[model samples]
Every structure is written in structure tokens, then in C-alpha cells.
Target chain A: MDEAAIDVRGLSKSFGGRTVVNSIDIRVPKGRIFGFLGPNGSGKTTTIRMLCGLLTPDGGEGTCLGMDFRTQAEKIKEKVGYMTQKFSFWEDLTIRENLEFVANVFCMNRVSERVEKALKGLGLESRADQLAGALSGGWKQRLALAACILHEPEILLLDEPTAGVDPKARREFWDELYRLSEAGLTVLVSTHYMDEAERCHEIVYIAYGDLMAKGSVEEVIAKTKLKTFRVGGKNAAKVREALEGNPAVATTALFGEDLHVSGTDGEALKRLIAPQASENGLSLDEVPTSLEDAFIYYMNRAKEN
Target chain B: MFSRQRIKGLIKKEFIQLKRDRPTLVMIVMIPVVQLLLFGYAVNTDPKYLPASVILRDDTFLTRSIVSALERSEYFRIAGAVFSDNAGDARLRSGKDMFVITFPDGFTADVVRGKAPSVLIEADASDPTSVSGALGALQGIAESVIAKELKGPLADLAAVRPPFSFTVQKKYNPEGFTRYNIVPGLIGMVLIFTGVMMTAMALTRERERGTMENLLSMPARPFEIMVGKICPFIFIGFFQSGVILFLARFLFGIPVLGSGGVLAAALLLFITCNLLLGYLISTAAKNQTQALQMSIFVLLPSLMLTGFMFPFYGMPEWAQYLGSCIPLTYFLRIVRAVMLKGAGFADVAPNFWSLTAFVAIITLITMKAYKKTLD
Candidate 1:
């Protein structure tokens, strides 16, 4: 096992007396893409900010890039490349100018060459002289990524990097992240997209300021202990309506033409679906529990408590 | 230790953005020129052509000569003639005339007999500045005109000077050119405008644009950021002051009598103080609008109470005390003393130290207010 790149305990933050990030712990090994999965305002952004030293946690003790996260935040900042949730670079400046400014701030040697390399690496060489504000959302995200990694820090903390970005751009962005991770850079990205979350080596789910789940995609789904019964028929919606109120059913979601009913108690789920299975023109089949279903089940359970 | 390279980088970035922002750049230069021209032509302490009505009871040549002489003095423009004292007072009260000159019913025989007839002059003194210079000129005009009128047989009366005589010599501004007073004070005004407003918006703009979080997440220190943000505007302040000073010297013919080194030193200190005060405002403001409001909030009091608009010593003791607290008040004194009064470094040392203290205090407060982390 490798040493954890980010190891923190009991991290919490509150804004105006309302806890935005409760006491949560996380540990991610080096060279892994860790995805932060949660609903909006679920402390994903706040936790990412805290981990990268952009924000001070009200209560937390941790190490980032092998330095004390609280007292040695500046030291940690030097080793971490943090890309904000918004396009935070100077919009009026050209792409080359923005990258050059970032490189200069880090006081890197051979700044022009480094900026040129970053521009070329991000496929922004053609638009190097274009103003950042003039770029489309996809181009802006690419430019932001290029600027953040100019110093080549050992850790990358990205806050919703692909938001509002097209699917093609997002796929290309993930491909770049994978390349960075393969080069021994630890990556922690906060995102709401399930596909993006699934691309991560490990994932942590948070809700209402609490850590609901944490593990690999398979491990997280297995831990949910959810048995999902896919119901397909002319009256699949009717089957969803029948099984919704049962104590065995945690969540019932319609996924285009099919209904996925899931619950934690497998025996109860099976017993409830058996009667539905015997109904005319109705068929029930057990399917592999997906990350989305497990997440929904966890979200519903958290809401219930 | 602060990173000089990072500070340089920040300044470079600022200049590039400033080049791109054409409107703000235009404002930076145009505001001072517009203010200079506006205040230069519009503000005059020595008001002329004030409306006056004369009440003549004697209808003597002497009264007519006095009225015409008053008109020729350019201080009084005869609006009309009033028949009674009541009408004269009505004209004064109704804002129709600024002054009422009344000649008593005593005939010209009194002046011919060397009895020294008294002519009463009533002036509206509501706005003291508008009336002060004209009123002061009345005594000289009366003496000269009466002396000239008493010729030949009245030459003895002309020879007899007034019971008490006094001469007023305006040493620095002999002609009472308001530009001489306003142009130097404008340096302070322009500095405050650019220094406070520009620096006030710098950090808040970053925060509003979401770049502040990225800035803080880097390895830069607060001191470095503060210096970087403020250093570029120091040049801007100098650029504005340079334009104003050039105009003051070449265009307005106002002299810079003090040592150039001392004036530059004072200006440097004053500009830094205002820029730091602006930075302090930025740390407290959440956005650019609030920052601009805060800058204006500071500007209003400084402009009103700093003796830039009115005489500093003429203000009440408490207002003077309040004015003394504003950096612009001291800077106005320093710049005016240097440029207008021909003051030396030693003469303006107290104000120099006061501005330095202001810079120190504001820098400390700004640093304390600028938190490294988002709380």
C-alpha cells in the first residue's frame, strides 16, 4: 500500500451557524483520481477548498502533500495545484498571457518556454493570443486546467472542473487527468456527474454536510447491499407505483422504459418483487447494482435519518 | 521576505489589463483634466459685477460721480435706483442686489464745507467669500474717488487721508487668481481620486471575478499581494500628479517654489497613504460596487472638510480637528505650501510625518484585515 497523499480526520466547517461540512475523514493514496460525489451544497466544494488550503476548516487536522494541512498551509499550497470551480484566470488577458502570469507567480524559471509548453499541451496554442473571456466554456476549462498545472505540483485539487462543459470536452479533460495521474500526480476532483465519478479510482459521497459513503465504485455499490430489480413491461410504471410504498423499497427510479427498484434488505426486496413477477406481462430480473442506484439509496437513507 | 518577482509579475499583469481596459484608462487621465478645467474657470473667490442699488436723496454731482466711480470699479453693477431706505432693504433681502449704497439727504454743501459727509454702504454678507473681497475694495475705491472728486478748492479735503489708513498687499497671489489656489490643491484631489478608487477596486475586482480564490490558493504571501496591487497604482498616482503639476506650471502659470525633491517626497508619501487606505477599504468591501461606495464615502468627507473647497482655518475648531485627521487635508497643506507658499522640507515636515504615520497605520490595518484563508 502506498502512503496516502491526502489524509485528514474530523474535518468540519460552518457558515453563519449552519454546518456546511461536518466532521468527515478521507484518505487517498498517491497517483489515484479521487472523485468527490455529492449533491449541490453538500460540502464537496468546501471540503475540496479545505483540503487544498484555499479555506480553513473550522475543525480539522490533516496532512496534504506530506505537510501539516493547518499550520503549514502555505507549504502545502506550494505543492498543490488548485483549479477553482469557476474560470478564475484573468478573462481580459490572452491565454498565453494568463498562463505566463501564472507561471511567473510561481516564479518558475524559463517562464516563456513553460507557458508555451502548457499552451501546446492543452491544445491552446492556436488560440494562445485569444482573450480568455472570448473563449467558449470548453476552451475556458481547458485554459484553466493549463494554468493550474503550469507549476506541475505533486497534487491537483479541481473543483467541478467539467461543469457546463460539453461531453466531448469533458471526455478529453478526463483523458488529460488520467495522464497526469499516471505521471504520479494525486488528483482530487469534485463533480456531480456520475460518469465522471465512475471514472475515478475511488469515490466519496457526502450529503447534508455528512460523509455518506467512501470506497471504490464496486466497493461502494457492494457496501450499499442494495438489490435492484429491473421491471420491464407495458405497466412498468404501475409496478414502480406498487412497490414504492413497501418498507423493502428504499428508492424507485425510472430509467427510460425500465423501472429500477432497489432496497437494502435483499430478502424483503425479492419477496415483494415475486408477486409483481407473477403478474400478467410483468417480468422482474435482478441486475447489478449501479453506482447511481447506490448513491440514490444512500441519499434517500440519509434523508430518512 | 516578499517575492519581488511575483510582485513584478502582478504589476505586469495589471498594466496589460489596464491597456485592455480603454474606458478606465481614459477616465484615469480625463478625470483630472476635466476637474482641473472645471474648477479653474468656475471657482473664483474674488467675485465681480455684484448687483448693487443706490438710494440718492441729494441728486448732487458728487453722488453721481461716486455711483459712476463704483460702477467703474467693476465691483458694483448698479441694478437700479431706490427711492427709500425701505426699498433698498427690500432689494437686499429679496436677493435682487448684493449691496445698497445710500447717500443722505444732506446737500453737496457738506462736502464743499469739508464736513466729511458720511455715505452708508450695506452689503449682503451671507456667502462671506463672495462679498469679502468686493467689500474690502470699497474702502480703497471710496478713498480714491472722494479724493479725486475733491479737487481745487477741495484739494485740502483730498489731502487729508482717512483718520486711519491701512494697505492690503496680497503677497502670494497678488491678483487673487483662484487658479493659483485651486491648481495645487488639485494634486491632492487627483491623487485621492486615483489612489483610493483604483486601489479600492483592485482586490475587490479579483474577488468579484473569482480570481482571488486562485490567488490565495497559490504560494503568494499577503504582503506580496498588497505590494503588488499597490505598486502599479503608485505609478498611476504619479502619472496623474505629473499631468496636474505640468498643467499647473505651464498652463496655469502656478509656480512650484519649494524643493522638487521635497514635493516629490511628500507626494509619494501621500499617494502611498491613500493607496493603502484604499486597500484597507477593499479588504472590508465584498464587491466592486461596495468598494466604490466606500471610496466615495471617504472622498466626500475629505473633499468637504480638507479645506480643498473652503479655507481650512475659517472652519470651526471641531471641523478643523476632523479635517486634520484626513490625509488629504495634510497633503493639501503640504502641496499648497510647497507649490504656492515656496515652503521647504522643514516647513512641511509635520505634514510629511503625519502622512507617513497614516501610511504605516493603514498598511498595518490592511495587512491585518487581509486574511489568507476564506473563513
Candidate 2:
């Protein structure tokens, strides 16, 4: 079998007597576009750090690219390009200068050629002379990615790289990620955006230091077994609030004029909503549960369990 | 190939970073130039214009001649009036004057009768400079005026011939030129103060901006990054020191009495210590503001205790002990010894080793303390 890009289990980390990343299992096959889904402060960054050998887990064993993690951090670092969540490149340098510096840091033999290729690859050649600080959010994001990938490592660990980027830029970034994955780079990106999550080949949902679920999108949805109902026509807010606290209802969110109500207790939810829909002159219909409802069910169940 | 490639690449990156950073560039160049000119010219502590108070109690012709002689010596500017009633005690207590000379009260009859009465001169011993000048002036006036009068009175009598003149010798910077002492010491101090303070906030600023995390994730090892960071500053320090030393020689006429080779070695040692110190400061500080504050606390005591502003001997006993422990203090001594006294290897060896030890200890601590985590 091809070597797994990242393979780990029983990972735990504590900070000042509080565990931030409890014993958890994580695996990403070679060249897969893997997504880690989590809310803020949800151990995602901690896991990424451990996997890239930037941090050593208190209790864990793992290998990245078939190399021992503890002894081979330098090797892993050499093989992976990590893009941090924040804009981290020196703002004083121009795009060209920033790329040249990164190339030097890697100590590439043909630095000029490498810098030229990275600039052109990122479509930043036009603005190569522009100060990195002057570049807009999108272009700056592109520049950061360019610097990270200049040395062309086998794996990329991007920590919420698209947090504040506009949609167009986010799309372009995702497109670049896909192209890199096609060229045999394993991209382990952590993102909160559902659309971004949907683009990944596989997804892992983590909450409060535990991996809640992991699989292909379809398999994860099937595992959730969430039955959803859409109730629409004016007064959706009142309906959403009314269905919110019901024991049978797992989650309720208002989608504009409609209320997307979901629960694992399909029969009880149907009984609870049938009478209200008829009396309020609203339409009630069965709808396919999306990743949103499945995630919500998993979150609610995780909370209870 | 690998080593050559890396070193060349790293040096290029360092220069690029240096070029982009304008404020740091300005500060490094400006502080030394301004300090050399300001302190070299304005801070004249070389013992001239001493204040003297005269008690002209005697109305004799010889005493009058003595008083006129005192006035003729420009070294002793008459700060206090010619008090008649021996008010020396109050004048000394108020600290308004440095010296009070009280000539004995007698008519010209006592001197003509060959009594050979003496005069009392009280000098403020608080300021060493004041006391030293006052004492020299007093000795000079008494011998000359007394010899002139005694020549007429006792030229025929050689039986009681006493020594008529006094000899004076100056120690440690004999001419007492500020540049000879200060510039040499300044070479040590300015290298450290600017070198460490400028590079102190380097990594921390990047860390605060969240750039360190990205850099950490890169393929480069920590040692590689560190060398790349410090090598450029070392070159800059060397260049700046050369300019300041040249300027001191050409513009201020400060002589480097010591061997240029030894001075160069001492300066190199000082720069390494400073670079290590800057790295340690950067490693320890959590943010740029903390780094800036820490630099102040480190450098202020460093400059003050190194005897840059005050002689090491002038400090209190405890302060002297503290000064001995600081590397800058020892380095300052070595620089001045070599550049002013023309000291050699035997002279600066102990200083060199002590600085080397300090650099080694701090570098180990910095290496151990710095971790690749946000926490």
C-alpha cells in the first residue's frame, strides 16, 4: 500500500493541567484531500501541530510518511508545507522578495528559478514587485500559499487558510489545493465553512478534544440517520422556536421562510409537527438530510453522551 | 555543496530583510554618530576651572604678593571673596567652594624677622577633580611666591635651604583627554547596546504577528534559521564599529594607543556576546513590547555598571563588585586597555575568556529555552 501521509492514535496534550487534545485517532491516506471540522478552540490546531511534528503529543504514537514522528520531526518538516491561519509572511517584503527569502530558508540550489516558478504558479508574477502589505486579502492569501509551497513538500497542513478570504479567493484557493492534490500532495486542511468541507474527499468532525465522526460524506450522513422536515410559509420563526425544545427534536434552524427541523426520532418528530403544520396553514414535507443536519445530530448526541 | 548553498542563501535573505527594515537601519547608524559628537565635545571632565576661596587674614606685603600670585594662576578662578575673619568652616560646610586658603595674620615685620610662617589651604575633597586641581595650584603659588621673597631675605644663608619646587604626575589617561578614555570604552558599549537592542525584538515581533508559526513549519532547522538571522547583524555591527572608530580617529583625534589587532579581537568578542544576548532576549520575551522593556532593563544597568559613565573605582564597594560581574564592564576595561594603553594578548586574555564563558552560558540557555510552540 502507498504510505499514509499522516497516521496517528491515542494522541493527548495538556496545557497547564487542562487537556486540550485528549487521546484521539487520526489518519489520512496518501494524496487524499482531508478536512478537519471543528468549532473554535477545538483541538484541531493542536492535532495539526502534532502531525507536522511541530509539537510532541504527551501520549501517542504516530508516523508521518512512514517516518517515526519523535525522531523524524526535522524530516517531516522538510516534507510538509504548513500554511498558518494568520497572515504570517514579512509585510515589509515584496511578493518577489518574500518568495526569494523563503527559497533561501529552504536553501534551494537554483533559488532564482524556484522563486520565478513559485511566483508564476501562484499567478503572482504580475504583482511580484508589489509590497506584500499592499496586496489585498485575496492576493496576500495567495502569496502566503506561494511561500509555503515554494520548496514543494509532499504534504500541506493548512490551518484555516481561508478564514477571512472572500468567496472568489476562497474558490481559487480550493482550486489550487485540488490541483496540488492531483499532483500527489496530501492536503490536510482545517476549515469551518461547510462548502469547503464538502470539497474534501473525507471529513473528520471533532468537538471538545474528541473526534466525533470520520468517513466519506455519504457514509457520515448515513451513520447520522437524521430524518429532517421542512416547514415553511410565514411564522417559520415561531415554528422553529416551538420545535426547538421538544425531546424528539435533535436540532432546529430557520432557513429564511422555512424551518429545517431534524431528529433521529422520525416518528415522534412527524407526530409533533403534523398537527401544527395543518392548524397554522403551513406546508410540511419530508426533505433529505444534509451534512448540516447530520453534523447537528452528531453534535447534539455527542453533548448527551 | 549543501553547506555553501545554505550559507550563501541565508546571507542573501538576511541582507534583503535588512534592506527592507528602514527604522532599524536609521537607528543603528544615527545613535552612534550623534553619541560620539555629543559626548566627545560636551562632556569635558578633564579638571580645569577650579573654584578657590581665599582668606586674606594677613595684610603684609608678602601676603599681598601671595594673593596676587594666586589670582594670576588661571587654574584657580576666585569663586569666594577675600573674607577677613576666618569664615572657612561655614564655606566648606555649605559646599559652595572647593578650597579656602588662610594666610597667617602678621604685619611685614614677622617675615622681615625671618619667622617663615605658613599658610593653611582647605580644599573640598568630595570631588576628586576639584581637590586634585586645588592642591596642585596651592603648591605652585606657595613655592614660587615664598622663593621670590626668601631670595631677598635669605640669599646669603644656605644653611636652611629647603626644596623650593614640587613635581606632579598624572596617572591613567595622563593628558586627561575624554576621547582617549571614552571612545575606546564606547567602542565596547555601543556595539553591545545597539547590537542586542536592535536584534532583541526581531523574532518576537514575527511571533506576535503570527509569522513564527509559519516559519517553524518550514523545512529549515532552528539552527539554520538562527544563523541566518544573526550573521547579517554581525556584519552590520562590524561595519558600524569600523565607521565609528574611523570617525573618532579622523574627527575627534582619539588615539588608539593599543594594538589595532587586539582592539579588533575585543570588538569581535563583544559583538558575539551581544548577538547571543539579543537571541536570548528574543527567545525569552513573549511580545515586542516586553522585548523592548527587557532591552532597556538589560542595557541601562549594562551601560551604567560597565563604568562607561563613571570610573569603576568611584562606585561604592557593592557597585564595584556588581560591575566586575557584568561582561560589558570587563569588555569595556579590555577595550580601553588595548586602545588607550596599547595592551596585548596577555592583557586581554582573561577578559576574552570571561566574555566567552558568558556567551557560552547564555547561548546554551537560549537554545534550551526556545521551543517551537505558541505556548
Highest-scoring model, lDDT: 1
What is the per-residue lDDT of model 1 for residues B78-197, given as tens digits with 9 covering 90 to 100?
A: 988989987876555433466788777774777766666777777654334545666688787877776677677767766665421222223345566666767888889888988999
Q: Is the docking of candidate 2 incorrect, acceptable, medium or high quality?
A: acceptable
Q: What is the C-alpha lDDT profile of model 2 across B21-86, one tens digit per residue?
A: 665576577657645643453233344445567776667666777767777865555776667534
Model 1 / residue A195 / CA error / Å: 1.8
| After superposition, candidate 1 runs with Cα above 4 Å error | B1-164
In model 1, what lDDT does residue B301 have?
65
- Each candidate's fnat: 0.89, 0.77
Clashing residue pairs for model 1: none
The sequence of per-residue lDDT tens digits that candidate 2 reaches over residues A1-305 is 65788888898988888787889887899999999987788799988888877777898888888888767887788888888777889898899999998888777889999898888788878888989999888888898888888888888999999988999999989999999999999999998888888999999988767788898888778788888999989987777777767888888888989998888878889999988888788999999888888777776665675
How much lDDT does each candidate structure score?
0.82, 0.75
> Residue A300 of model 1: what lDDT?
76
Question: What's the alpha carbon RMSD for model 2?
Answer: 14.3
Per-prediction DockQ: 0.59, 0.44
